[model samples]
Target: MPRFFSNKRLIILLVGVIILVALIGFSLRDRERVTLPEQLIKDAAGVGQEVFSKPAGFVSGMIGQADLLLDSYAENKRLKARLADYAAIRSEVAALRTENEELRKVIGKQESLRAYNPIQATVIGRNPDQWEDRLILDKGANAGIAENMAVMTADGLIGKVTLVTPLTATVELLTSAGTDYRVSALVQSGSGEIHGLIEGYDAERGELLLKRIPSEFDIQPGQQVISSGLGGIFPKGLVIGEITEVTTDEFALTKMAYVKPAAEFPMLDHVMIADRIAPEIEPVELRPESGEAAE
Candidate 1:
């Protein structure tokens, strides 16, 4: 009997659940006015759904935004890397452009003095103990450079080669202290040429002294002076300088002029070595061996 009752209760419970489901479906049908309690339950469920959906949507949006921010940071880093490489390339291009311009100027200087063989050399060394006037060249005897060769810049003569080694050469500038070397020069007057001797430099005056002027009246302050090619050491027509001041000696015998040097000595750089031509050998006169001694 108890077992029968238990079966009957289970059947009743199943039936009750089916009836409750049916009632709920009928009440939820898209239709008319509902009871207050049913409306209250629906409202409560809607509120619960809204509260959960809002937080879920907010968390999804935050994750999406974080992904976008990471992409932007990566792009910025890539751009910065490219910019650094571009800056390095640009700096190298600018340096090469400047170097090309300097080389062009050196070529132009070389072409102007086309008559003489120009041995272009860089100034390798200078002695701080000596004045800034002295210079040492990178070319020497191995390069056919010898003593007494004239050293000139782009414009005019600057010095003469005094000492030479296998790999280097020393040049004594015209502005050196206690320098007694002289150069025979000519003053280019309008009518005729006047002779002068470049003797020494005047440090206080910052000009060179051209002493023993043949005619002081012929040489004005603006007259040009050039090498006369008298001693054959320096080339003819090489410009020395222009006269700035003229005066007579204390003994009243000769005139002196303060001439500005054409070449700037303090900042000597690329120089040209005027390679002098080989001296010509005199021809031997032919005569009989017995007749030459008797005559």
Candidate 2:
């Protein structure tokens, strides 16, 4: 009888739980029929929108950053290319400037040569030996410059052409000590004729000795001397030098005179080539002072 009463209590507890569940369900159905609180519905919608748009905002920010990076990269590449182009242009400008300077010098030399009716040439090279006084020019047979041509500066004669190539030539200067040139000159003081041969004394110092001047001629210091044009090689009346010293001997027929060349050979930069000859002079006959009849 006690067991039956216990089972009856269990059944009553179950029935009570079932009735409570049914009443809760009926209450939820009635609540569904009524509208939700406006504030609560708005709050939920805002939360859902924020959650949905968060990813889109993040994606948009990423796209903007990527675009900025691409733009920056393109700008950097363009600047680098421009810099390279500018560098190339600068190099070209520098080269052009150098070429222009050289051209100007060449033009100046051409004008000077043209004024003197001389063959234009460029000094291409020089002798390596300090003792040897020689220079090579860029003009040669192709330019009408030949061997044995007289080379003179604006001041005076410098030398003669020794060797020539198609486009180049070599000059043998008067300062060369190994050379022997007997040149006839006129004395400025007494209008007397004198003869002298050049000899090299010192190669390094470019010192030349003039030997063989007639003693009867009154050669004085600072007297100008010029070529007599006896050999027909060099033109007449070209200035040679001035007499610096004169030593006369009582027993000797010839006097020794030291002449300083008019041209500074060491400083020779440009020279003229005169191929034209001077006009010939008429012969003069001497008459007797006592009015003697013509033979």
Candidate 3:
């Protein structure tokens, strides 16, 4: 080979240009085989990615676990509060049950004293001559009020419906001086209940006379008296009054107790008339049934 220049560097440069052209041609040619250097470089990059991804996945998993723990803590607090509230409600229910049981003992076997339907009425008139005996209400038969239905104030029983019209009804107070006026009453003595009749009123003392009590029974002052429900007119458990004095009849056959009325009859503005579920039935005459002759 002839030296192209008298320099060793020029000879090296001509050979380098030939090798560069050969490498460019080899790279551009269509080939499926990968070069060894390229394979090594790609494998190193893949290894680095795998090494870094493991730590990233571990960190992400730890973060997710921490979030779940925080959420569980919050939910536990809420559930504990609800449990406390449930305990409080249960205690209240137990107290109410105890109170109701005590009330049942005091009221006796009467399942409910308030079983009657109440009709609200306003006092529209009071007869001056019969101020302590009779008053008129604004509701009557058309309003489902009937004769002998018990009338009461917020405090206690006071009267009964004696007459009913379309738009008005007359109520006879317990303080009436009528000779025939009577009420079946029960005196709640320490011994037991003493059945009696409320036969008369003492206008002089402003008290009621609960008579016909058996002399054997011991009744004292300050004992309570209520309607006995033996009379078909009044419902059971109507509070009448408290006893103030006790005495025997003229014949000494029975006892009598003076009762201080619970209701203030003169201050009556609003009243409730009790319409009992059970009504008194009148006997019907069994006459000729459709042309049958009477005996």
Candidate 4:
């Protein structure tokens, strides 16, 4: 130590060590507040730490938010692509149906009530008050829509056009409470066709009523029900529903069958309007001869 440092230098080093030890002992005392110099040094250090840490925290937060945004964008893009594919598929199916009808005509097949042109349409509006009773379509008179035209979904028949306007048409569903609304329906069984009238809906059971059926018809559950083409509105072979339960009428004279509808009435979206090419028979009106039958 003597060779490395002169006497004066050694003395200065000893003095510096003594001062550092004294400062440490002073800071160790349990005081209420720090000294002015110590407080100043601590404040500067805190400010420096906050300045550096705040920017780092902000940058990290921005990166995390950016990652979330990127993920959401990717998901939305994927969904839009899938929706486009679905729309294309619907268009292709409609085209194929049209082509099939043309091919049938080319083969000179017998014209049947089941043969009709389909007009594609979309459900636009529904009245909350009337809910299952009625709905409105986007197509109207300009689209060749007429009243009494059968409206159906991909699943099966839903209703018929009751009113038409220039740009919109209203449909009265099979579930309507009006007693005047009736559909000529028939059940297809192994033996033959059993005719009945779709008169009302059983709200409690969520099924349609096929009434005025002969008790001897031997109808049972699981038999398919379809339009009979006698109603003059709906074409034949339009799938209405399937039989679920069979019961006797009030007088036990005729049988009534509860039918589960093929089309989902509560969730209608897209539909087709059937335009009948072959003429249907109209109801005949009786005329009094020479006012002899005024009564």
- Top-TM-score structure, candidate number: 4
Worst 10 residues of 3 by lDDT: 281-290
For candidate 2, the lDDT comes to: 0.62
Q: How far is candidate 3 from the true structure (C-alpha RMSD, Å)?
A: 43.3
lDDT of 1 by residue, 165-187 (tens): 55567788888875546777888
The regions of model 4 sitting more than 4 angstroms off are: 1-110, 283-295
Clashes of each: 0, 1, 0, 0
Cα displacement (Å) at residue 157, model 4: 0.9
Global local distance difference test of model 3? 0.78
Name the lDDT value of residue 79 in candidate 3.
91
lDDT of each: 0.72, 0.62, 0.78, 0.80
Structural similarity to truth (TM-score) of each candidate: 0.54, 0.49, 0.58, 0.59
Q: Between 2 and 4, whose TM-score is larger?
A: 4
User: In terms of lDDT, which candidate is stronger, 3 or 4?
Assistant: 4
> In model 1, which regions exceed 4 Å deviation?
1-115, 278-295
Per-residue alpha-carbon lDDT of candidate 2 for residues 65-168, written as tens digits (9 for 90 to 100): 89889799889988998997898899999999788779979786332211223675655456769566787665666778766566777787677776665555
Worst 10 residues of 4 by lDDT: 283-292
Clashes of 3: 0
* Clash pairs for candidate 2: 177-200
Model 1 accuracy (lDDT, Cα): 0.72
User: Candidate 3, clashing residue pairs?
Assistant: none
Give the Cα error of residue 265 in candidate 2, in Å.
Answer: 2.2
